[model samples]
Target: MPFKASGRATDYRAIDRFDGGAGWIAHPEETMQRASHVLRASGGEADGGAWVVDPVNADGVDDLLAEFGDVRGVVVLMDRHARDAAAVADRHDVPVYVPSFVDPDVDAQTQPLGGTLPDSDYEVVRTVDWPGWDEAALSDGETLVVGDAVGTTEYFRAGGERVGVHPLLRVKPPRALRQFRPERILTGHGEGVLTDATRALQDALDGARRNAPEVWLNGLKALV
Candidate 1:
């Protein structure tokens, strides 16, 4: 099977619903040339049921929903990653949560995320807070979900060599997303870092701060 831009084959696997009624599902395939993931965190009696974060449009969504529960809401972590959020939201009849900087493009239920996640246990930390651009990290205590703010694709290409941060933000130099200090990180453009996630994030932040030549070159490659 052909892999997505992350250079990894599709990995749509069943989410493990925890005893607390919270779990997650990953959309194996990439649409619009990017990897995507979803978090199934329940809100409460007020909310219909479980909610999703940064969902990608794929065939497995319906099946996952059926297996899990109702998807009451969707969250988009970055402006550039709103590709399939609307479709997924509409399919499940849920609202789409996004930062004010994001443009959903598609016609669906969209609402600006006022510095907080909808109703999930996860909390968002703004990593890229530039004048015109913004990106954040959503953490559910154990797992951290990120957008283009970090990546693992480039590293996968060099035979599992040391992976680095996404190149584009190297120019501005990204701040360390150490607020959450999660053990695992799920990204929107890579296979994800499950081991030493905090250390890996720090290393990537260091590389971005120095504006490493390779990092810049790789960021350029992302454009073409």
Candidate 2:
């Protein structure tokens, strides 16, 4: 589907709240909302009440909300710096939990999904996934928020290889799942949501990388 936060024009205003929001990513990809992330506050009573922080480009975030409603528990599938997810947590006043590889400052954070959120201003809650925490499963929505691990700009990369050409739509490597069967994927840059061509690519990549161990090893190797 075309980018739309429920038909709302791509909103740069939401991008202004993060650490160096709009200007943080100065690369050419940055011009098109690269490195930007998706802010998702968790909901429902059965699951943790925290939010999901997937760093997607402007269009991805917008279309994601439109397709699946607000996110309620952050799931970071990559280790790339996710545009200061803590700031996003603070914006919604929720806890931020990211993958361990994300290199976050968990000492300053907490779990937002749980109601025990401290009275103090929002801090980070870096979950540092030692085991797989499919927080997205908590939501009735099938949408998964995978920071930069999933969608990204056309030519966005640090070393000189754009991930679009890489085997998987992944970055910062070291993956766990052999394939991501997200009904809808919100990329941080380039085309935000994946439904048609992007969806087909996701399926193909998932099938090729069924060797979870090798896929993760390759991803980590690429980053290292």
Candidate 3:
């Protein structure tokens, strides 16, 4: 894949696949694409215009954007070690959201490199303060994007689904890929276009209301 501009080569790896609600695993057929990332529309026709999440490698933003032809907005999630997502978002005309407290301007140059984020790029305010983690809005179907506020990884697995973070990267549980209970998932580099992901996500939301409240609070705590 083509790079964004010209400069230092950023460290980026591609996993095989990412399936929200189902899980993630390696694509034995294809080799990982570390130099670039990818994204696709999820939710289908009923979704109207929901898109999947994608994490582009260093200088790989252009390749990811090519899929959209031209997009409206992108919710950016910054990982502690991910590349400067804001610049990528800014360059693409999308708005990047950090863990509530992250400064788009300052952080645009601080993130380290190599990691995953809440695939969604929009903000799901649930609170009033900054937290180490937060959600992003990428696809419609009531989808929420998760940033690297929590962790990073190459592949994701759960329930019955399996997908890689990109092309060449493989995620290790507990560390690389932070297993989530999302109804549908959009990786920092790719998006999950599920047909019934909304319902699944809604259930997760309701469940969070019942149990994840404290986790959300923890994020709020981090912001302060």
lDDT of each structure?
Answer: 0.60, 0.36, 0.33
* Cα-based lDDT at residue 95, candidate 1: 82
**lDDT per residue, candidate 2, 113-144, as tens digits?**
33121221232223224343221211113343
True-structure RMSD for candidate 1? 4.9
lDDT of 3 by residue, 108-217 (tens): 43332112233333334321123543233223334434442221222222222233222111221122123233445444333342345444433333333233333434
Q: Against the correct fold, how does model 1 do in TM-score?
A: 0.74
Q: If the candidates were sorted by their TM-score against the true structure, best first, what order would they fall in?
A: 1, 2, 3
* lDDT (tens digit, per residue) of candidate 1 on 1-224: 13333422244544324332322334334322355554555543433456566665554456655544567677788766666678778877878887776654556777777655665677777778766667877777777777777766652222222445665565555654756677777776656667787877766665564645765565456445
TM-score of each: 0.74, 0.42, 0.37
Which is superior by TM-score, 1 or 3? 1
Ranking by lDDT: 1, 2, 3
Best by lDDT: 1
